[model samples]
Target: MRNMILAVIGLLLLGCSGGQSSNSTMTVSGVAATGAAVSGTIFLKDSAGHELSMATTDGTFSFDVSALKPPFMLKASWGGKTMYSFAAAAGTANITPLTQMIVAAAASSTDLDAAYQAPSPTTFSTIAANLPAATANLRNSLKPLLASYGADMDPISGKFSANGSGMDGLLDHVAVTSVSGTVSITDRSSGATLFSATASPALANSVSAMNWANDSAAVAQDPDLKVSEAGDGLAVWWSYTGTGYGASVIQARWLNSEQSATQISTATGFAMMPKVAIDGNGNAVVVWMQSDNQLNNVWVNRYVAGSGWGSPKKLTSAVSSATGPSGVPSIAIDAAGNAVIMWNQSDAAVSSHFDVYTSQYSVANNAWSTPAMLSTGTNSAYGYKVVANNSGTAAVIYNQFQRTDGRGGNGDASDIWVATGTTAGGFATRTKVSSSANPIYGQGSLAIDPAGDILAAWIQNNNSGYFDVWASRQPAGGSWEAPKTVANSVTGECYSPEVALDAHGNAFATWEQQLDTEGRQYVAASHYSAASGVWDAPAEISENIGNTYDQHIAVDPSGNATLVWYQIESAAVTVRSAQYLQSSGWGISQLIATMGAAYDGYTVFPVPRVAVNSSGKSIIIWGTGSM
Candidate 1:
């Protein structure tokens, strides 16, 4: 009887085990090509069109893709524009072929989306008609996977087509204007055969190395910021002491052989206080305070994705006399590559009191309108920051006080004010954004979600000998909501609040807070759900480190967020990070290995930044004044 029971148990175990999948994850590596890496986002789409992604930096990225199927699609994007697309299949020993993507400047998203024409072939043989050259070895290696998608590559034509289903369904939705380069897949586990899939070689390869730049500083540079669209990121800052105290912009990109930072700014001036914005098509606008011959003026420059930088032009058409100061410039760009620049000027109305002014960049004419005063005040305004949606709607915020000591209204009894603007009328009337009748302290950040909802976070005096962070939101075509406390429930002072929102209208806010219990400062983070209309309880992102601060957060369209900051545990400050997924909440916080080191006593903690894409890939950056 005992033997019978044992045999029955064994049979049950075998039955349960047989139902499990034996497949392991396959790792795929590829280069984004220098130009694509700067202007495109990288994506791995599964059979079901689910995307797994990584930031394509240093020209290479590897993914442990779920091996549920055999074929997958690799895609690159620049905002709404699709830069390039490739196909991949599984290989042995967890290895897949290295893909090389040669990309170039794509057309407007509207034109690119309309480029798809169909009679979509379902089999490789059917679409293979246009192949410049294809190989039989490639067909055998890829047929099974292609059959699954109803998609296949013609070895002779070196082109891919679909049967109007599966992965092809998603691909059909995006336009493919052209194709070039060699895309191959192999089975590396053993003596597996290789695949030769060459698309059209006649297609031009417009991708080239990026003109990236960085300011290596020995002293701390204030007001440095970076932003990205698609997969490319642009970082700009004026050195506290670069040559002639000049400003610079760097285009960080991936390449076939490596990654690099190329300088794109060659303006002749004592430039400082730089502000930059890039559109989805990789076009960028950089504005800085240039003191030429001691005359403070706002100058602007443009960077086209394929072409490089353009000569600097003055954003403010109102000429500032030798004594008149035109500084504190802030700029923002829309998806269409239109830009708006705002600044505080002493010469706008010829009063010692600085008034807020703005100018809009018209892409159609490629010219900035004459400066229009947004804030008509006898008092000076400072802390100019601007944010805009791709729809030509934007807002600018600044601290207003009766006096301006040239410190951006910081450490003063200032009230934060905001003004709404449109491409049609520039900025409209001024409105107060700060909820507190009390003083609004320090600089704040603003972001617009995909749904057109706007969020602004700033620090305010809590009257408890410490400051607190507060937030407010304005829905699309709606009024500004009452201010809500973001991270002040704890028993510490919070400041330097930064906020971002995902496409779903989910919001993530991070700030530096002093812990009353430990007497140490750390970074605190929390999120809000528009569906629930409530904020999550705040959580400490950095635990008992000697010092942890200067964190920034960026969220993807999928409501996932990547938050980065520095930990001064030792003499060297290490860059650490945490990720938030809608499914799992915050993941294990880990030290990112890509950033360089920062030593205390010898170096200032580099301000850290994080940016994430809809596919969950993120670019995390931190640097010393010394690049």
Candidate 2:
């Protein structure tokens, strides 16, 4: 009987090894040529059009195929475009043929014979043939004027003189005949024409000029404060404008309500990164960085429920000089309305020195405690992101880099570190949550669960020689689980990760990814599951919108997540928002407002920030040119 049992165990072990050897595993890897991965879906399909798998993250992907098939093709899609496609055999490994996949993913004719063909004027002649005769007559009227200007039409702005004199003299001689035309704007999703009007050339020109001037002014302001929510309700905070200079305290009841803003305080210098948290009695604690006399310092202010705003108190005594504290700062408030602020301070006096500092403000005593150092190491510490639970506990996450490290040259090798504290004050020590061997480079964001578990997300330079969005979760008292790549895309760089945790601990992360073809920036998002210990494949949130950057995501109490970002449209940066529908995926994007026109020969980049409350409403604030 013992001999029989041993024979059975040996056969079972041999069977397991044979099964593993027979399985075919293929790993897909590629890098985005642009800044990040574009939003879209990728699927592995067989010859019969059967879907085998899908990819969400941007960087690299792996698949284990038990069944063998020759010439299996994988397709990657984003927006209305298929960004990549490649063929694989039954036993292939390390598939990195990105060129062919990129070519197939471009906007071109699928027909093999027509692949290289470019459409000529003849291709559009059919549409021209259907044009009204009056339209042709209008074109004929401009021909003589265009010919007089050497084949280029100088209609609105007359040709300038060679001596660089004003063109108003030439403009007087040109006569623009009034031609009535109809304009129509249709809702693409609803198949309804929302607006239609008829106007003459003079009216059109007047409206165009007005719009141009408005957009121009809007862009010139650089950073402008926008109200996210308002009117005596739940969780209200104010956003700063003017290159993140100063902010006011805005009170709001819900997301869509108009905000009643009260100027909290403004220094002669700039202020930025203002954070606000509300206590049970409707009191608010606000903290931000202030700059004056070339020195950037931290400040805090409080607003009582019945009383008015309190006097601004300076938290940091660091002088802003050639070497001073810099980068973005974060703040959180506890139930007692005490404020906890964290910021990165550089000590130029010490070699290889940068540290994360924290301080506490007591509402009862109306005083701030002495600042405490949270990180102790040789590397430069930066990118301090903090979150506070009402239970007087706050968690801070930041990137720590070792100077002169060979890994990514200087400032290349970094990792995410987390520090937890019982009070909304100083941290005892910070522990490294990310793996030490595989360090992350870019800045990361953090979200804390109701139970005090910490979830952090950041962009990491992976072993595949590309950057991808990675996430790490640490239970309340346990060590951090292994880091996992959330979104898999190989077309571009992924950076600026922001995460939001719902009440149930569901995590949603959003970041900017690059497209393979146009090199346009796109927004991608994914969710982390605690039970499965796996990140759901990332999905593109914005499809029609392109050139998106600085995406911020927030989750409502209903477990729905809303994503907001700045997108370039018609040469202006516009703030756009998209909400995640429970069963319908992402809703159609809506444009919030346009920032303004080009500034100093370049369009201003809109770095909008967003926050949402438990009531399924959100407030989005951004800087823009004044009207």
Candidate 3:
């Protein structure tokens, strides 16, 4: 089927000023379907998305429109219907009476409200309030396009009507960079096109093209288990290489349980390892590394509650001697939707010329600060893991290897360091997390409680021809607790530690270990009691049948948890899972699926990610294969 190209029909035009001025002026005009006089408010907005002027519409609308600059946007809306269009200012800009009809006919107020509440991955809501009932932290950051709305009557038809232009806002935000872009509306189900247009680069990345679905909720998916405090939804992000494009593009998809997934990646490039941070409201911030024709740079995209995803903004400039290609990005969002993204890039100042760099997202300014170096005087740093709590403070922990100061036990040893940040003050100086100079292996994981307390897990060299999982805890605004062994000394070659903090302040830690007794690898877990400040004995969770690898766990608000992993023994690989009840310990491990032919004789590695909400709803995703 051919894609829908909505033809925006126009009527008449009007303006307050008869002549031109310092800036270009655009006048928008509209008329009732019946050719009768109607009333509604018209708003004039600046290029920065700030409201400039508003007036009553009497079958026509007009404004100075000078602040909006060239390629201006005009909107005419009333009740549940709004029609908006973009054009250059040679003369008057014409608009349709009902460019977008939310309801067939405004028979009742409830019908109008329902149209306003419907969700569309391509469309955005006009209201700017924080929808606590839907999700406390969910919000549409687009400033209101209208100052207010009122009730009016048709002069000729004598019918009551909603007297306000329906246009909520436009992508008139201040441009982060002057790159031209396109705006497109797509079908979440099939990636089919609905409507699209070329626009200033700022507008293209700031809004998603959308059309409403015929349902109570908007069409979307929650594959990442990022349940919306505003409602039930999930979100996930990834990057895939393209054949013809010659560059990889970052991808994001979100949906409710009943809806199909919506893809939010608008551009293609050499993007990889996309990371996400969803707030309590299901609003998300996605960050990834993309290589232009030249070098890799860090870019970020944001989803406004009710509105959908916005444009991607570059966080780093071209790679200079001062900085190299940005990669291995990680991000965390606070309850308020504020976010922080960090990555390791080449810096001339660092000893190895590669150091940890970070940028903080400001909701007030709707922009990211220039990338700043967080690791200084360190020989080399990488493997950054970051997490933010409700209080807006974030903890970043990464490995600093081959130090010039010789603090590490071995000259080549590496240690984990922690950095903290707030909206007011960016990341503080690095704090050594691991005590010894021994090498820390893999990426470190950090989790923060509501009170700002933190728990971290990582693999460290035991120095006795073996490796073990170590743990650390920090009280709110206090010094770190001495690192302690979280694993049983039952074997060697233990690593890949992951940590999760439940609502009750309990910290759950899981890791992979080689079993000498069984001559195989197994998964082990332990629980930490916040009240007693003690850790329970480690328990083996995987069967001895095969090599247990890539374990993932997510706990609901009730403290119930689900763990997923893949086991490879011989020719066939099996995906297995188990449940952990608060009162009863782990349930029987169950078979999720079997995969052998899927590999097609090629070597395969799987790392599953899991997320669960309070009601036991879980979303599990993995690469190569999924359960």
Candidate 4:
């Protein structure tokens, strides 16, 4: 009888402890995505590198962890790359590029994947203690992008779907990529660099440098940035405030090679507005306007593939007759390494009258031809651009004034004109491109494809109180099509139109339109199909959050277009960019950078530019100042 009583006592004791064991076991589940869903194998690991559970997931994963760990790690191994996540007390942990970045930051070892595969005890403890701080840094770094979503949206612990909404939507616009020990965060839609840091144990501290985007940095104004791609390499040029005569100097950064920003201009003068073009053999030529004590002239610098930048050469020597400034230079290189550079030189005989001049560079001889006038009329031929096709055929476009009275003044009317030829020969065979009687306010944009097809866009006064965006096309060996109003706002005014042409002659145009004098300016866009030969209806690409200005656009060979602009929101200003995929219509506008709030009544203006390579990779750059 006594033995039976003891057995009953033992059974009751076991029942009392059952609830405790069940409470210790935690079930963790989440979705893995890389913009879209990630189909792979998910593994739940402890700090000691032991896999507690494994599950095959088609984006959604579940794992019942028995031995609960404080710093639990989740990894999803896909085909190309693997993503990782972290959980303090397991409930939900989504494996994604963002989480992978956090994991890399928290890990002690430089090799992220290797460290996660088999973490030592000391490294594991380091990760456990550093995870919280690393996560806080990430949140602060992406504060501008997370403003629309909840600022406290936890990428690791928050529950989310892979359907591209809320947190998932934010992920779609950002690109978190890791190479070796370096992690880079960029706007996925525009390829604008947001933040980058080394994935070391000190990443938690270094990530704070990204605050420079919000809080102003010592970086100079008017980054007049330009970029070009040669094969898999990229060359970027910009002018920044340096201690010199004009307080600015030109700098170049080489990407996918020895990554560094080198000053390409001498300290004797100030260099500004540098344009770069790279050939197929990875060589590049950068052209810019330099101002000396005497006059403003055009300068050129050559960069060899394996070699570095060569000596700077002055391309423009003032003629005895025309001694004024020579500026607004444009450059293009053909397949054979020959280059054409065009600029506007002020005619000394007539004040304020500028003429277009051209200079050709022969690669075999490594010499530049003497500058020669290319414009025909006596009026100012400003805002000229030159583009080259693969076959060495080059085209130049500019805005020239025409007055019925044969005089230059407020009564003069302007029209767009084009000239076609080669770098070997001068740009001859000039033709009129626009038939508008209205005056042109600014220079028109020009774009050309590999087949010598051309597209141009400009803002023309609609004879009303506002301006309209007009575009024209020239088929290969065909005449210029009639100018059409691509974007006309009956209620608002439009200005600053920019156009881009893809490899197949499809075109994209973007501009800023103000709904009313009291309303904020909005960014608008239109698309033209080469096959249908029809311009699509204008679409508002901006979110109408603030007044927009300094808009720019570029299109890749795959027909993907990226548009960038400055948006003034409340007291702060933001640099925003949007992507138009050939497959999908348009992605949401992404905030690339932002500035702190400024004093009331003070306005800030930032100019944005974009360039794309043949493989759909794009680089966006902009100028930032006090907001």
Q: Tens digits of per-residue lDDT for model 1 on 166-226?
A: 3333132321222223232222222111222223331111111011112332232433444
* lDDT: worst 10-residue window of model 4: 1-10
Writing each residue's lDDT as its tens digit, candidate 2 over 417-509 gives: 888885544677577777666557656888886677778888787676667888888887778778888876677778788888877777888
Best by TM-score: 4
For each predicted model, how many residue pairs clash, with residues at least 3 apart or on different chains?
23, 36, 21, 0
- Each candidate's lDDT (Cα)? 0.55, 0.52, 0.55, 0.69
What lDDT does candidate 3 reach at residue 158?
20
Write down the TM-score of every candidate.
0.62, 0.58, 0.60, 0.68
Kindly provide the TM-score of model 4 when superposed on the true structure, using C-alpha atoms.
0.68
* Global Cα RMSD, each model: 16.5, 25.8, 18.2, 13.8
Off by over 4 Å in 1: 1-230, 237-262, 317-323, 346-353, 402-412, 593-598, 601-603, 613-616
Clashing residue pairs in candidate 4, if any?
A: none
Q: Report the poorest 10 consecutive residues by lDDT, candidate 3.
A: 168-177
lDDT agreement of model 3 with the native:
0.55
| Candidate 3 error regions (>4 Å) | 1-225, 230-233, 239-241, 257-263, 318-321, 348-352, 405-411, 488-490, 569-571, 600-602, 614-616, 625-627
Local accuracy of candidate 3 as per-residue lDDT tens digits, 548-592: 887877766556676777788576666567667675677655555
Summarize candidate 4's per-residue lDDT along 1-627 as a digit string, tens digits.
011111000111111334433244456677777666666678777776668645453577776654645567777887867777876555667777777777777774446667667756666677768888878766644554565444346777666544455676776776777654546677665465565545664442121112223322224244443334432334344445645467676777653233346778776677777887777676788898888665789999988878879988887864444458887689988867789999988766675687788899888888998888887746677778898875788888888877533235454678888888887776878888787677666558888888889888887777675778888898998998999989766778788787888888898988888888567788999999999998999999999788788888877776877788888787567777777766557766777776545412234455566666665545555554435
Stretch of 10 with least lDDT, candidate 2: 1-10
- Supply candidate 2's per-residue lDDT for 457: 80
lDDT of 4: 0.69
